[model samples]
Target: METLPIVPDAAVGAARHIDEYAAAGARYVTTGQQGAANTQRAYAGDWRRFTAWCREHGRESLPADVLTVAAFVTALAEAGKKVATIQRHCAALSKAHQLAGLPTPTDDRQLKTLLEGISREKGVRQKQAPAFTLAYFKRVLQGIDVERLDGVRDRALLLLGLAGAFRRDELASLDLAHLRFDEDGLVVELPRSKTNQKGEAEEKAVFFSPDRRSCPVRAVKDWLAVLEQHGRTSGPLFLSFHKGQRLSRRRLSTFSLNEIVQLRLGAPYTAHSLRASFVTIAKLNGADDAEVMNQTKHKTTDMIRRYTRLDNVRQHNAAQKLGL
Candidate 1:
């Protein structure tokens, strides 16, 4: 019945002492490398929520019973949790059970049926981030004072995010080493993204605009000069600033990036708007799905279509052209 006595290696190995046996058991239970930092954090948080709920309701969280999981998810739905959120909670529960070497109750018919009912009732369509107009974005740029350090940095940040159609995390993770410049434009080396996790390197090109005031290439060059002055030629591309606007060496968090977007671009826009708007604006201006996908790095046209894919249904609706 002992954990140590059951393990195949610890059973026959000469290191049969309790200490060595315990060490061997510990090694097997070490952290899983199944996902990115964000995913791990999400799972950890979800597990905590599950454990807390169990404590309140007199149910077991780990090696959880099917009825209890079904009940918990039902409660989540009653409490108005999104279908996506409920599904993630189930995934977290499964992950926890798998790591602990237990048969996950999520696979049981009761839980499965409960989730399907929840999905059918709630519908699985995710709410997309609101995208703003390119004209509005340009007006925002005109208002910024590029002469100031923060202005210079923020302008570069917004432009690169738009032109590259970068995901929020990708935009935040940019490093000096990821960039290469030539006469025509800047080439950004994307080693990893949510879609491309194999670490296969991909390149995105941002060309110079004849309009100097709104050029992504020029804005980035200016921000790099600021970085050079601060002796930060490598590491995270964006940084947090001190109280007096003195630059802090610490890299900006994704939350801070969203705050920046909300602060400068108005409250309706989140960091996702940069990418969504890029897709929307490009498609509206006659870029085909393939052309939009090229900038967005989307593996398929479906996601591109979704962003065609709308703040207002009227703006990008296919019906606009029906002369009827």
Candidate 2:
């Protein structure tokens, strides 16, 4: 029988150290659960793409050099990726490198200059989601049969989403316990949101409309009555149902919220359209930047102005007021 050579203690120790380092790097990559689910998924995908590119080019991805990063970004630009998307990919790669105890290439002046050049060459015009205006909302209401359980739930969702300028994820994450009803209207306590990532509690008030048909508060009450009839006094504000119409304890997902809007409008409106529509409609109806921001919870006036400017192009144009 052939005798196997014994491995040295130093070689064994080095192998163990390599294994521990790899394990730690992997743990660092996946340990943090910060940000929204969508954001996390996007970052993961971006990092995977970067790693794949590095493997293809025989470069070290964790400690990516500045030239490699610049080339990667340039390739992305050549492939017609949006400037924002390229920037996000860079952020993901930098974060991964940082977590893995490697130096990030993001601070390199050459990489920064390349990104700036790409941004200038590509132009940074983001496509905005179309707004679902009040007129369109009224039309949707006319088609709904509120007598049905689904209709009742949809009406409440639509009104609340519109009036509160809520993101789809925010609406889907709501619980019955977070809502308070009074003579004035309804108050919703949001535990966490995209803006409030630290899980800070934020309160949003939705007032009653004079018209019962258009009143968000009344619509919520109606939905709650149905829930009460079903003996559902707790858990998610919106629940899923079986084909037999029996309610399940499962909360509605954000994707479902998007589907609800698209089905109601019979158009390509997304869940974000509700929030954008609130801003656009508010601006069109003479609401100032401060007023719009108060409801939308926008951190900066610049974003509010973007929505207002689109609506104001025709309605509030200074050139239109002047006779040529």
Candidate 3:
């Protein structure tokens, strides 16, 4: 065997340092623990699109110059992307540069001005998800046969989602271990959520209604009984059935929750509509902002106010008290 030249100690040290640096950079760029899975996926797609666009234009994507970022935002605006989407794209680029240990060009005055201009040129108003009012919820419940396994699961899912003011992903994340039952109702412990990404568990209470037909607590108990019969005592709280008949061990996805809402209501309502409806109904029923926030887990009063648009107008109407 031919003897190879021995590597110098200094050179070896430098090589090891470089390897460590590269590993740290990789962790910074690829770690998915910072945000929700959906957010991480969206950011990844946005970054890929930005890099592809840069390659096509013969420009650098990582550590992109201020002018390049400004032009990219302008192009996105021209492409009819919503202002919020463009902003998210910008944020994705910023995060990429940050991970690479480069200063973000998005913070440049020129890029900031360009983004503001884009927002002004293309309206900043986002299309709100339609609220599934209590009345509409009752009508949907009337159609479901609570005696069946699927019906029991869906009733429980829908009622808990609305009464607990749960996001679709939060509802889907629930497991048998997360629930606690009592005479009053059930308390669900959310280990992680969109807002509570740090895994600091938050508990939401769902009270039993006087009427069994619309009671979330009773609905959940009925579903639990069905689940127990299937010998599923400790998996997902809500599961998907095979062929709409036999229960499967699979957990329901957030998309399925949205589809469930739309199919039940026979309308375009999304899963978020349940959360919005909870806030809206609470406010309309004279629950204060803090009270609404408690159930919705909203951190800001501004968000609560926005969700209660009709209630706000009614409560503060100048003409109503003026007897005009």
Candidate 4:
């Protein structure tokens, strides 16, 4: 909440204007109806970077002049920043301008033209997928002792993430009533999911039908029992130690999955990788693509195919079947 530094007489007005603009922008961002925590964080980061850049360049706080904004962006791009990065910066600047009731800096036709040109020039692509394997997942689980509260929590998280193919946000949003254990197996109801589905989000369930009695359902049941023992129920499933507050998706970085994968597993993995792992393992165990898609709430069969098909593993298993 630090105030922007005051500049000398020349651009003093502009400096004050910029500071006001930034303050207004923060207020506007917080007022957004779109409640995605990640979106809020990204917007905050982008604007902070833009303001810091302005400070670095000895420019007044407010980017009131379109030309000054243009030159600043150009300098950013010239310094080897990626097109996506530049676009994010532009987006932040545009938002601040809108909040400040100033003219949109990124709205200039010339600026967009330059952005397109730079995008085509770079041809940048998303980074490669994080490396994750079953062995690494096991190691991460093994590292935590089952005696502690956190250990039980981590185990539940890991199992549900792999067994249910849950996104981190969905996992965080779950409540006690979302789960039910009958004699058959475990049933999970996802009331709020991030999909292109209609209405109040589609509800789905995953049944653990393993040959053995002690299956994934058993693991979930045990976790729940531990929670019951600790007198936890019918609230935010994952609570933070900070005054026992309900953990938000914004706290997802503290999940330890990525840290475990990178440090212990020595493999690059993310929350999404667990989703992929579920689809792949289910298919390997003879579950059809349709079934996998249903559990994952995937709308497209084509998208399911990409995750379920472990090409190299299939080929290797086929060879083994032929005794080759």
Candidate 5:
């Protein structure tokens, strides 16, 4: 006969703590639904790190007063931590306190004061991320030999990232069912991504081959055939052979497009460079902003335009036209 499973008392008690807290103000803030999963998880991690710090400092996380928070922030700053990192910890602490039905130490007044002080000290400014270029990508691709697993993985990864304009997280989440190929071309279906439309994570589709004559289309088609040869059907498309599981978002990030560039081409580039390259390449190929936006699934055409850097050929042609 089948038997019912038993629950550990300690585990049950810990869950009760969360349920009691949830009954308070936590439910009003975030339901841990929709796209807030990442936010919630981030806050939770921040809280854990804060609690660990608190224990070392001889204080309780929940019951700590404003003085403790001030001391923590001051100590963090003295330790040479960035203002953003300190703000993350503060945000986490505020959220955790609110959830626990305790008085928030970092209220609006505190947050405003901290922000103003940080701005004055650090000089508030936004730093633009480095963009990827085609030449850099080509150099990276050249480093990989198609005969090895790493090569296969890198080739498949670089193409998917560039062709599909997939985010690092989405890259790790790719499964076999996400791809479909026929005589016409290849279609990649992303059920959920960083930018979801209407609160339902967006599904992305890409037609690399407009008329069955694109190198990108042919490359991905070849990769799919190799995937089939492994006798694999419906699981993570980017598998981590070491773990024998799907690739993780964090792990994928460790070896970014920059590392890929450095490894293959002896240059540094970020993962989003592939995205920029995609936009620029698409535009040069005569695709309009709307067409590129649809492919990239960018919420705004303006943002898409930013990624579509001007190619040298276009610049030279425009210069010649000016002379004419």
Candidate 6:
């Protein structure tokens, strides 16, 4: 005769627990979406470099060993890579290992010490973007002929970028729909930024300048008028041009902003200089850290101090006040 088997009580509870946690387990696939796009891109590129290096050296990359990882970064250091770049490589390795369901060697104690040594040796002073003086800024604006499509767009971009203390991404991400102009001046509704990644409601004001030629508000208005002429009322504030200088619906990239800055200002300057220059100039003109932070949207005063490149020691030094 066939006998019926009895199931243990714990077996039913264990099966129920597995079913209860099924949603959480399924949600794990969305973990990659947690990081910003730029960060994800950097990690991906760094991982490719690391994997290629491993392949060249005949070392395994997926299940990377501590010694191999250490040696890889050492090679990068010997190759004169910056400390930040080397650290990013290690971070990329950690991500790669995590994706493969393995542990990262980057968390190894020896690797941390090596990274500290690299930081000390490399001198953790990152080169700041060169900012413009007010005189030069005015002169550059004066030289641009705003009658053309390219000229107007570039002028508006530069002026708004500087006055608004906007990052490159912020500038590139601008849309006409988010802008609000009042009697005081223009108020930009910033939807997303590096600090506010969840699309918070942050706004920045660009007041009218005493000098109409260099006014951020006026420049933006003129650009809008020109865009109206071209039937571009909404969408990207700064659009790219075609071969014949005809405007396209495509928005300018962050790199394009750098190119515009370098082409207009000089080689040493970049898109970041707009924001940096705002902090430096404002601080020199006696704007406190809080005042500057309000415009730059920086989370801390330390960043303000770092961005303020007041290199004129003779002008800024307290020795003059000491009666020396």
- Most accurate candidate by lDDT: 6
lDDT of 3 at 159: 91
lDDT of 3 by residue, 1-324 (tens): 121122243443244433443333334444633777787777777776776666566565545789888888888988999999999888777776676657889889878888888888888988887776688789899899876788888888889998999989999989999999998899999899878888896899999999898999999999999989989999899899998589999999998888988877766688888888888878767788988888888899999877764634555455775766
- Which residues of candidate 5, in runs, are more than 4 Å off? 1-41, 58-60, 63-65, 101-105, 123-129, 182-184, 197-201, 209-214, 241-262, 265-267, 276-293, 300-324
Candidate 3 structure lDDT: 0.79
By TM-score, how accurate is candidate 5? 0.67
Better of 1 and 2 by lDDT: 1
- List the global CA lDDT of all models: 0.80, 0.79, 0.79, 0.64, 0.62, 0.80
In model 4, the clashing pairs are: 18-62, 131-268
* Clash statistics: count for each candidate: 2, 0, 0, 2, 2, 0
Indicate the worst ten consecutive residues by lDDT in candidate 4: 245-254
> What TM-score fits each model?
0.83, 0.85, 0.87, 0.67, 0.67, 0.84
Q: Summarize candidate 1's per-residue lDDT along 1-324 as a digit string, tens digits.
A: 222233243233233333342343333333452555576567666766666666566555545788888888998999999999999888877766666677889999867888999999999999878888888999999989877788888899999999999888888888889999999999999988877778887989999999998899999999999999999988988998998779998888889998988888998888998999899889878899989888888888887887764556776577978989
Better of 4 and 5 by lDDT: 4
Better of 3 and 5 by lDDT: 3
lDDT of 6 by residue, 1-324 (tens): 211122243343243333322222222212443455566667666766665665566655546689989999999999999988888778777765565466779999999999999999998878789878989999999999887779998999999999999999889989999789999999999998878778878989999999899999999999899889889989999988999888888999988888998998889999999999999889878898999988888899999988988888874566877975
| Arranged by lDDT, best first | 6, 1, 3, 2, 4, 5
Q: Candidate 4 — what's its lDDT?
A: 0.64
